[model samples]
Target: MLKSNIKTLIVIVGPTAIGKTALAIDIAKHYKTEIVSADSRQFFKEMEIGTAKPNAVELAAAKHHFINSHSVTQLFSTGDFEVEALKVIENIFEKHDQAVMVGGSGLYVNAVVNGLDEMPEIDLKIRAALNKQFDDEGLEIIQNQLKQHDPEYYEKVDQNNPQRMIRGLEVFLSTRKKLSSMLSSTKKQRPFNIIKIGLNTDRAKLYQSINLRVDKMMENGLLEEVKSLINYRRDNALNTVGYSELFDYLDEQVPLDVAVASIKQNTRRFAKRQLTWFRRDEDIKWFEPGKPESVINMIDQELKKP
Candidate 1:
């Protein structure tokens, strides 16, 4: 039985195209609560189709926060999200004893659940120099530097994401401290109880789902959507899987078929990275995507704990 006085945050995490949004909606409806999205990609208003945001029906099924909350032109960092999401959760707690948080972005989720460590203030000049180096020397140069300086973060970071690579580099250059080493080892306590549920399936099945989802995105006019955002192609938000591949296609770097195939391949690899990150969090209880009842029972079990 759920205690009336105990508030719970049900965190739904998993790889892309693994039915997290659907499960989260059902859970939110069951608890008579709202969902707070931690998916960084879905936060941008311009990134609808490619990000696989909740459809109109799903959004209507339950209230959601942070989906399409920011414009791609704005720089919404993890720290910003941490502050905003906490406020959103606190607001939800005022009305309901349980709230749902769902997303696949590991760092953003970690920021909310574990709290980000205080980062050393980076020098603007240092940041400018790094950006210039990226423009002149290219992503490979910065990626190599990060690998040499912070191998641990290098292994986990999205290597294709120059922004993340530059962040790791700038932190090291500014403070002489490795970015990975600066991550908080200690978990922060939240006022509400947290019930983390991870959704996953067998490897082959998950890969197949990712591939199919990419095909669905293509059919849903992802190419047209990417073309609409061509003006913002250089933006950090577009430096992601779906948009980047289509941008390459537009630049004549690859054929359309090849670009679509690359999206599938890259998405599969991304799912693997997501699983790796979530696996480290022993607090999360794993379940198949089809099993929401089991998840709810587990949430109930956790809520009843003293």
Candidate 2:
């Protein structure tokens, strides 16, 4: 039996561009519960286009929590998300027995469902110093240092991701502690039964969809969107796959075509990493993307069980 029986809430998770939002909306409407979005990028109000935030019609369909709800300037973390999501769930359960939580961000989802490892607050001075190092010494130099100090973290992390590499090194430099040590500390129990439903399809099909989506984003003035947020380019929220490439283009570091290509490639790689992360979690119930009725029926039976 599961540890807690305080009613089972549904969580629909998968890779980006995998259609989690629509399915989650359907389930929320059927169950008459609000949705607590776990997509880390969607939390910032200024990041709609790049984050692929839910549309007006979807928001009107159900009470969506945490989508475009916070400012980019605010400090947000998985631990903070866990606390806020639980509060939302508590309020939701008061009106309905269960609610739906959905998104592709594995860490945020895990933070809510299981819990997050305790992490120290990052000092702005440390972050600024690291940012300067990235600017002057370049990412390769920092990455090599991390590889030397904590090879385990370097292997698992996206070496191209400055935000992640900096955070890892920050923990190490501040406390003389390995990033893995801090990250693997412990897990706390939550007071709800989490029903995880994952969606996936053929790899080629998924990549094709991602490429097409990138093209659509460009058509929808994604470049213009990124241009407007140039001031906040250094913000963690803008460190995502789509915006980062265009930021490079705008900086004259890369050509327009090259940036667009990088977006497609990076998005594909991100999707693969998302699948790998979720696959490591054995409790997730997997399914192909196009089966809402079947998926809900399975959850309905589980929820109705005595």
Candidate 3:
């Protein structure tokens, strides 16, 4: 069923540096619509270079929301994004027939489009305790405990994400309720029709593109970007792919070359995970990245189909 009589949202999503931004700008221009970003990392003003925020020309071209619009110190989450993005969309729909939501973060996109399950408010004490356990006992120990307690969530979650693991264990530890149980709740209906467009390519070619993007980022002064944000290293924004590996280098845990290679490897892994998450949605209309005309025509066809 159509969720709205007036509003439509075109969401452009894919892995990082797969040309999502360029395509989003083009679509936004085509529709004369504004764009809302679902990328969690790009929200921070201090994270310009590492996040690959749109350059000035692209930013001026598209009416973009949530790009470098928040401070790193502010606590934001998918829930916050859902609230803000919906409000933004409500306003945009006042002046246009469609709006665009674009980013690579799967959870953020799901929150905006499919809606997130309502979980309990986080208990700081429990979170602190879990973090201490992670620090003292190491991540593997926590991961193992989670696997034993909530195997379903362990399977669906990104195992490398310590924050998510900690939150899962926090809920299980506090209420003895499985995190997966909360996640299994029914989806909430939104007031706009949602159209999902997924970008993909041959696995080998995508991985090669990811590797090259990492190399270009390093050559373009990603190190300097991380260095500038050294004071904010403890911020959640720094807990991302490129910056995290650079942190390991700064800590002397590995050589610079190894860190760069690890960034490329981890980014490719992230892209793989993104594909895995997005592929689960049967509603997504997949397209190759280079075929803008085909994608635009496909969207037009879908929208026009009564």
Candidate 4:
């Protein structure tokens, strides 16, 4: 590749609780560039403590996009993210030769680095009806509906999350096709060069990090934040690990201690899933989170690749 034509998107990816935010800041500061967060959960303005969003200091350390950029009440999908992120990258590239994208959300990263297939627009009434059914009946009804409609997606989706179940059911209903099918069509090529860096550690260490992070989130008033968002619990953005567990406790479905334990355990599980998804991307060079300089050097080398 010619040096004059270099426009790189350095994608930092890894499991939750693996210190991705700090590493991304370091790299962006080194490159004198900005950051685009691909963590789907952090996109909502109403979510903070539960999404493990970057602290005030971190946000100030580097210019960031997509954090607190949307309302939890709004419908923001992966396809939407691809569109917005491309626009962000285009504007960023107009000034800098490189930009950093960091998050544990593999699909969101893929959407930006690759692209998204065309997803059919579901009728508003369909989602409205599904929401009503989920409210009146229960997640079980929606769960069964998804299983019956798109068994493939239902098998992989978080069955406890009504948002995922409803999404799968609505896609199937709207296009008469499986959401999984739509996602697996093909990867779209992007104009700029992409270099992916993955951070990970031993399982025990990763789990330890997850546990400690959950404990820290609890100490940081995660319970209170969840309680405050109780009215938005049914919103798609709140149907995630940390917030969902606390919401369960708020509803008397579990004790506080049990809910805390659930948050830690579910976070570990989520980290494991994130690693599995990222492992499939052979382009992502793995690195220890502590070795930022090495990771940066690797990016420098990859960008220099002929």
Question: Where does candidate 3 clash, by residue pair?
Answer: none
Tens-digit lDDT track for model 3 on 1-306? 344355789998887778899889989998899999999889999988777889999999989999988998998877899999999999999999899999988878988887888787767898898898877876788789899899867755556667767778888988888987886378888777888999998889898988888888888999999988889876666777898889889889999999999888878887877877788888888888877888789778767756
Give the candidate number with the greatest lDDT. Answer: 1
Cα lDDT tens digits, model 2, 240-293, are 789989999999999999999999998889888788778877778988887899
Regions more than 4 Å wrong, model 1: 1-4
- Candidate numbers sorted by TM-score from highest down: 1, 3, 2, 4
**TM-score of structure candidate 4:** 0.90
Candidate 3 residue spans exceeding 4 A from truth: 1-4, 121-124, 137-140, 151-161
What digit string (tens of lDDT, one per residue) describes model 1 on residues 185-279? 77788887788899999999999999999999999999999999999987899899998899999999999999999999988898888998899
> Which pairs clash (backbone N, Cα, C closer than 3 Å) in model 1?
none
Global local distance difference test of model 3: 0.84
Residue 195 displacement (Å), model 4: 0.3
Weakest lDDT window of 10 consecutive positions for candidate 2 = 1-10
The per-model lDDT (C-alpha) reads 0.91, 0.84, 0.84, 0.86
Name the candidate, 1 or 3, with the larger TM-score value: 1
TM-score of 1: 0.96
TM-score of each: 0.96, 0.90, 0.93, 0.90
Worst 10 residues of 4 by lDDT: 152-161
